[model samples]
Target: MSEKNRDGKRSARERLAAERAKQNRAEKRRRGLIVGAAVVGVLGLAAVIGVIAAGTGGDDGEASGPVVAPSGAQGEDSLAIPVGEESARSTLTIWEDFRCPACKSFEQAYSPVIHELTDAGQLKVEYHLATIIDGNMGGTGSANAANAAACAQDAGKFVPYHDVLFENQPAETDDAYAQDATLFELAGKVEGLDTQAFRECVEEGTHDGWVEKSNEAFRSGGFSGTPTVLLDGTNIYQDRSMTPAKLKQLVEEANQ
Candidate 1:
């Protein structure tokens, strides 16, 4: 071979070897990124599992802890009171924590069905805001929010305030999002609520006892989690996974 041709062949071989090395490095980087991503995903999953397990106290399903409730509180006389219409034959009572994420999930999943049923006069929903998991799940803010909800109930704005509470749920902490100003703001969201009365009730914590009493009643009734739904007074603990179709079927069965 001529010297120039031999030089060109050598250069080509060098370029090919350089290309191979670059490809190897790129492959290593890709594998490292994938491995790093998998590790992060696993760590995140473990953290979430830890939080859930801590929240549920290890989930032994045994009520070994002391039952928390306010003293000398009687259950509400109209705990199952129909709110939609008198002709509504069935009642769907839900005991839920305002700060509980699972409760929020239930609301997102099942509230549309509730609206439809209420509109059709087939169902009336009575919400009993329970604060059993407030301190543990969120904080004092959860209890305060629950108190605010009860106050709204006093002004007959429970449903509207309920929606607002869920809408503004403290994603980081379970603090009351509807502060005094927000409470009045949410009152405006409801048609008939007297904003002044709602302000007074929330300020004085007038509904605090009621929320406590509801929590007590839920504990007495043997509920272990938030969003414990009652379809015509029968406890439906499966609210988390309950779909609209399944709820409709359950409601029909309850009616029968």
Candidate 2:
């Protein structure tokens, strides 16, 4: 081939390579935009849910009562309902909404591992309750159920009652937990949790202020959504690869 022809072939190959590189960069940018948009969508949804919660402002525009912390409640502002021994080497902080289906799913998937670790005195779980569902879906079930759980705490039946709540959690759109009778009925499942004092606590929304305050913490805390499981201050639930075995390994490794 002539020198000119060879030069032209070289130019053509270089142009093709440049075009391919440009297309690859565009593809990368497209993927980045997609991921970024998804994150923004979640944050935006959370903001909208927070707005709904603020608008509801308790049973009727805010729970009109004193902020009563439940028995043995810990953490800042007494918002954390703790489980397991205080001396556990690892602390798992969980912020959840009773009406949230995602929260229930997390509970179902990880509760056994959690129970095992807690039972072995290897981990402590600090449960922070939120009422975002009430704010988003328009009902007091979240607050009511949270208060009932607090009442259970007072009776030393928090763990079991907490499990029962999630086990029987109604659809996100259903306000079944809003009814005292339903909460009372569930309480019956746990021995010695259905006393008159428990009844009054649940009926009176004794911890409504506490639940509301905890939710405010969630909104202001910049969390993405429910089941914000932080193991030793790390947001493990957000990790796509997190699993029960992985959590167990982390806790065991931490103890070592």
Local accuracy of candidate 2 as per-residue lDDT tens digits, 106-152: 99999999999999999999999988888788888998999999999
For each candidate, the alpha-carbon lDDT, in order, equals 0.68, 0.92
Q: Which lDDT tens digits does candidate 1 get at residues 142-181?
A: 6567767766666666677788778766663635553666
- Over 4 Å off in model 1, which ranges? 1-76, 79-81, 172-174, 191-194, 239-241, 252-256
Candidate 2 wrongly placed segments (more than 4 Å): 1-63
lDDT of 2: 0.92
Q: How many collisions per candidate?
A: 0, 3
Native-to-model Cα distance after best TM-score fit, residue 223 in candidate 1, in Å: 0.8
